[model samples]
Structures are given as structure tokens and as C-alpha cells.
Target: MSRQNQGNCDHQKLISETDTPSLHEDANTDSGDWFADMFADFEPQNTTDGSYRGTMAKIKATELHYQAVFEQKLVEANTNLKRERIRVTIKQTGNSLQLRATLPLKPGDNSVGKQKKQYDLSLGIPANLEGLKTAIEESYELGKLIARHTFQWNEKYLGIKSREKQEIKTIGELLDTFEEKYYQTRQKTITSQNTFANYLSVIKRNFPLTHLATKENIEAIINSVQGNKKNELIAVTSVLIKTFNLGFQLDVKRDHVTPAYREIPDDEKIISAFHMFEKFALSRKNTNISDEIDTWEMWRWVYGMLATFGLRPRELFVEPDINWWMSTQNIDHTWKVNKNTKTGYREVIPFVPEWIELFDLRNSKPLNILERKVEKIASVQNINWMRRDISRWFRKVGIQFQPYDLRHACAIRAHLQGIPIKAAADNLGHTVDEHTKTYQRWFGIENRKKAFGEVISQRSLIELQKNEILALRMENETLRLEVEKLKLLENV
Candidate 1:
């Protein structure tokens, strides 16, 4: 029985030995072979006699521990990434940090392949999550503020804050944009085009964009040119204000560049000038000299047209088919004078008898003849030259007035003749308020008093006539009574 138990124990020991190999034996065979193949360049110093296997085992254990630690760290990193609400990406080029907040897509938004909308913080990388969150919140608030003002989330609104860094850094560039916008939208007339061109040229030549950007700089520019070139300054300043307002949405007041005070000439001087030119033109017409007749006739028509119709110089030279006659024979009788008008179009009545007579004479002639004469007159080209010629003629005739003064005189005449202010303004192509303000000085209290006095005097004259007629009838009755007494005495 003892011998049988010993044999079973030996068999159990043999099974255990076969199941588990010795650590040294395994390290020398399988582990050593794997380590050598993996790290062939690793040269372990075999200083102790049997230290090689132990060293290999220690290295394997160390590697396994570190691998487990590395796997744990990777899992923690992925979990932290899932917890992040805002993803911050830092760009190296602009040194700007972009924060993308994970928000639900807008209702109509189809973010099929598009990346989420990211708000640019334009900041450096924050030291921590708290700092980053603070920056993102601040940026989001700023964006909200910008949107509140009705500005788009674009460079245009951004440029307003950083104008110096904007592409339109110069005044010329701004004006160019303004002019382009103006011409694109507004109706273009030759006079308006010329005027805008002149404005652009003057501004480009005189003022720099940087200099006119601020109010103080603009004021300084105006002050420098105020004394001698006040009119030019006024024009340039107006253009500048318009350009800046349209381009940059700036508000530049007209009062900032007030024009110098201009003295309006007396009404008598203006009226006298008109009469003087009329008499001179009539004298030329009466000469009956054939060669000078056409020239004299042209001047005659011009004088009558301007004085009667209160027309600008350019209106006289409109296409003759336009029929400036304002006759009842035509549709309205209120002639529409729309040629080169500063305020567009206006309707005027033929108030002057001479104007009617001149139109009659013109209609009597062939259409081609009238057109030829008009072209001949317009051939003078420059209206300014025409003004100079008219001024020179006035000088020759001992009158002191400009061609524009004639229009002013017409305004005065309209006021004195009891024409309604609105009617006069419409005839003159001006707003009633504008006409009133401009000609207020001409419509003096003294003139009103004189008109009232004249009316009263006429009524008093009628009363006096009635009283004189009654007294004469009484005297006639007394004479008849004397005659009757005389007849009775004769009969006795």
C-alpha cells in the first residue's frame, strides 16, 4: 500500500512539473529569443555570471507595467475630450484662437458637410480652461453688441472700428466709391455730372483723405481756405460731407463749413439793369440793318425770354420744338422749362406782353429758322462766357449787375405784384420755404406798407369823387330856385 501511494505522488509531481516550467528555463528559451528579436541593438552587459536571465525578466516586467499605465492614461484623455463643451483651435498664422461652441444647428441650417460656425476670439492661447472660457464669453458678448446695432457680421462693420486699417484708407478712395454709388442710383444730367466731376477734382487736388477724416482736420482745411476762396471752400466741403456720409455713414454738418456772407444787390439796381439791357436791345432792333438784324433779334429774344420767363441762361438754348410759349392754343399753356434747370423742372406763365409778342414772331418764322438761330446763340458754348458777355454789355451800358441778378429781380417783381409765394416758387422751380428765406430781405415791411397805403388812397379817392358829385347837384338846385324867383318877379 505505501509503494502504491508513493507511485501516485510521483505521478502528481510529474503532472505539476510538466504543467509549469521553471522561470529561469522559460527566460533562457522563449523570453530571451523574443527580447533578442525585438531589441536586437540592445547590448546588455553580462557582468555577473547568471545575471542575464534575471535582467531580462526585470526588463519585461518593467515594460508590462509601463504599457498598462500608458493604456490607462489614453482612456482618461479620451474621457476628458468628451466632456469638453467648447473646442478651441489656435492658428499659428494670425495668432488667433478660434472657439467653436457646440450649439444645435439652426432650423433651416443644413450642416451636411460643413464645419460648425466658429467665432474668432483673435486672442492668444489661454493658460487654462477658465481663461479660455472667459475669452470666448467676452467675444460672444462683443458679437451680440455688433449685431444689436444692425451691422452685418462682416469686414465692413469691423472696418468702421478699425478705419485706419481698412482698404479705403484715403479720401479719394471713399469719394470714388461715393461717386460710383451716386451715378449708379441717381439720374445723370450733364450739369449734375459736371458739378460732381468738379467736386471730385477739387477734393482730389486739395484735400487728402487722411486729413479730412476727422472733424478737426476738416475744420482746419476750411479755415486755411476760408478768406479768399470761401465759395470754393463751401463747394468742396459740401462734396466732402456728402462723400463721407455716403461711404462711411458719417454725419458731417453743413454748418461746419459755413460760406462767407454775400451781400445781395439792391432791387432798384437789378431792375434798372434789366431796363437798360431792354432799351439797348430794342435800339439795336430798330436799326433795320440786315446784317445786324439777326444778331439784334437773337439778343432781343434772349432779353425778353430771360426777363419775362425768369429762366436760367441754359433754358434759352433748349431745342426750339419744346415751345416755351405757354400759349392757351397748346395743351396746358403752362410751359415746362426743363433744360439744364438746377432744381429739375418748372412751369411758368407768359406774364410779359413782350414775351408773347416774341413767341408770336418766332412761330411766324419756319421751325428750321428758329432752331438755327437757337443753335447760333448756343454755339457760344460756355454759359459762364455768356455771363461774362452779358456783364460786359451791362458795363458798356452803365449798369452794374450780373445775369443772375435778373432772376433775382424777377423774384422781387413777383412779390410786388401780389403773386402767391407758392406760385412764384413753382414758376421759379424752388420750394416755397427756400424762396421765402432767400428773398425775405427783398419782401420788406416797407413794401407791404406802401401797398396797403396805395389801396387805402384809392378808396379815399372814390369817396371824394362821390362827395364832389353831391355838392355839384346841390349847387344846381340853388341855381334853379334863383331862376324861378327871377321869373316870378318878371310876371308881377
Candidate 2:
């Protein structure tokens, strides 16, 4: 049998030999008898073979031994308490240990409308050595309280202070508290504030002031949504729940949303869109020459940058200067994405380096779309507006793909050009895993076939060339043999 089972059997035999009730009730008996019986075979056998299983077994054995010691200490404390007239005995009740004492209660301390003895003052802690020591100290404090006639029946003594009723807060009121704390702790950027505001709206929609922030109500709200939305709801709700210590946890798995694959536009389509952008600019120009400020060329430049660099639509509005683009420090001619952009600052290299010059991006002026300041357009409130305007402009130019598709196209371009996954990810401001996931999912069989076809074609061409060389050598040998045979005929 295992040592642990043997020890347990031994413990049971020791308990059977002594009166079990006496062990609980009688404190006058010497604790040493119990201690000796419990620990007679408790010493570790030095079986410390360095393995996880062995270490765990040792730990478990040590824990059981300590528990036995704690129990002995409790019994010893009772004997001391009885001799000192403390009038309290420590008892092991279920999994927890408590001080059992008969103390006089103050007036109106009982539901019977009369003063009487109160028993079982809870320690409100786990039954361990530390808890035992703390409970003994508390017993001393209780004894003093009884001596001073200050002892009373209160939730504090019963360890129900936290369980006491508190005023319920409205969802709206709690949201106000959450907002104040959220801003105080988090970075106070316009984008961050706007994102928080969006989260607040989600919370408010599901749980208005009329709805209480109860566990049941939150579950109901979570259940109302499906897929990624449910996960998002749980995520935002957790922030509020944790902030207030709401005494519950969300135990939901993130429902994986199968994203729809967006096809990356080819180089031809992107180049076509660049030409269309010029026509779009001409179409937007006014009959009154004074109104024309070359707005279309600015947008065309934006399109070229997006197509060439794989920049996020919002990233264009982030403050970038000619110096930033043409910095001497950038040996690779890579430009820095602004720190305020979504993924923060990253150095982005164009997939097609020649596009920078072809689009005349080096000589490009600061964008002046709609005469709006760069900061104003890129601000949290208007960033969406900027994206929408870009989208609308694309539609006017008869482009079929969305603005973000260009970013995907760039990723594909980088993949086709044999860019390392890490390099591609770093340039695009994505993690390697994210880059792999995005491209590999849609990088698909067609691209694979194309790559394989190129390899096969090269191999076939080499094989054909080798065959031609062999045929030429055979022909030359045949001509030499024919000439030698003719010489023999001439000698005859």
C-alpha cells in the first residue's frame, strides 16, 4: 500500500483507540498523546528522487503533517484557555475552525428580546496553522471584550460584515463611477476615450439605469448576443464587474468568428484605380476655377500611398512630413508610422519600392482634403468620417475594393516577393502569428499553383536543353562515322 494510505490507516486506528467524542470535547487530556500517535510514522523516508511526482507526494505528505500539528496546537490552546478561565474552547466545525464560547450578550442582542449567551464566534478564515494562530489571538481579544461587558451580537463577530446589505446602484450611476476611474487609470488619448465611450454605449444598451447590475441580468444580456458579439459583451462587462468587485466571474469561452475572406486586388486593378483617381479629381473640380484647390490630386496621392505602402486609412491623417518620409536615418528608405495611429509607431517599407517614385510621393505636399486640418480629421470623432469619405471617393472612381483591401494586397505582395514572415509582420505593424493567419488563410491554392507552375516550367526548360545537347552530340558522332566509312570506300 502507498505510504499516504498507510498513514491514514494508522491515524484511523489511533482515533479508534481514543474516544473520538473526547478528542473533540475534552481539552484536559494531554495533547502529547495525540501528537505522538499522529506523528509516530510521519517522518519522510528521504525518497527525494528528483521527479515531479515524487516532489508532489512529498508536498502532500508535509501538508497532512502540518494539518495534524495545527490540530494538536488547537487542543493545547483549549487546555490553556480552560486553566486561564477564558471560558472559550476552539472547535473544528466542518472544514473551518471556530471559537466556541458562552458569553453574556448586551441588551437587545437576541431575537428572543432578552440577553443570553452567544456561541460559535466565527474566525472567517480557512482552518490552517495561520488561521489557528489568528483565531487564538482573536480569542484573547474576545475574552477582554467579555471582561469589559462590551461583547455584543454583531455581524462582525459572525464574519458576515461583507454579507451585510448595501444600497443597490443604478447601472447609469455605476457607469459614471466606471468612467471616472477608467480615464484616471488608462492613457487619456482621444482614440482611447472614444473607444471607452463605445464600450459604455454597449453596456448602456444592454443594461440601462432601469436594469440592475445583478449576475442574472448580466447573464441575460450576454445570452442575448451571438458569436463574437457575445464575447465582446462579456469582455466589456468584465471590466465593470471587476472594478466594483461584484463577487462574480464571467466563465464564457470566446466564440471563434469565422471571418469572411476578402480577395486581395491584383497590381493591374490597383494601377487602374490610380488612373481612375485622376478622373475622379477632374469630376469633382468646379466650373469656377477659384474653388479648385487640386483636392483630387491629394486624394490620388492618398490612394497611391495606401496602395503602395499598405497604410491604414486612418494612418494617412496622422501627422507625417516630407522629412519623415525622406529621413537620412532610414537607410532602407522606410517611413515611420505616427505613434498616435492604431498600432502605434512602426517603420513601414513599401512592397514595391519603385511605386514611391512612380507616384511622385517624394515630391508630394501635405494632404489638404476638404480643407480640414490633419489633427481634426484624425481625431476620435472624425476618424470614421475620414474613412467614409475615402470609401465614397473610391466608389466615385469606380473602384470595386474597399480601402483596407489595399492593406491586404500589400500583405499579399510582400508574401509573393519572398519577404520573411517576421519582416512582413513588422512592416505592417502586426504580430507574426497575425500576419500568418491573415495571409495564409487567403493566400490559398491559386497562389500555391502559380508558384509551383513557375518552378515546373524552369525545370522543364532545363530538361529540354539537356535533351537538345545530347541529340547534337549523337548527330556529330554519326557524321564522323559516315566520313570514316566513306574514306574506307574511297581506299577500296
Going through the candidates in the order shown, the clash numbers are 1, 0
User: Which parts of model 1 are misplaced by more than 4 Å?
Assistant: 1-115, 118-178, 201-216, 225-296, 318-334, 354-398, 443-453, 462-492
Best-performing candidate as measured by TM-score: 2
Residue 69 of model 1, lDDT score: 40
Among these predicted structures, which one has the highest lDDT? 2
lDDT digits (tens) for residues 107-156 of candidate 2 = 44665754567577765644654446556666666765654556776677
Tens digit of per-residue lDDT, candidate 1, span 1-492: 699999887655544433333321332343223222322233222211112233344334534543344344334333332233113232222212343333334335587976444443333332222223334343333433332332234442233333444233456556756665344222344445655666777776777766435555555666665443544655466556543442332233334343333333444544455466456656777676674444434544455556666666665554433454535466434456654444444566754445455344344343444466556553324544544555565575566555555665567667767789888876766556656755665555665676678788889999999999999999999999999999999999
User: How high is the CA lDDT of each candidate model?
Assistant: 0.49, 0.68
After superposition of all CA atoms, the RMSD between model 1 and the true structure is 31.6
Query: Would you estimate the TM-scores of all the predictions?
Result: 0.48, 0.59
Minimum summed lDDT over a 10-residue window in model 1 is located at: 43-52
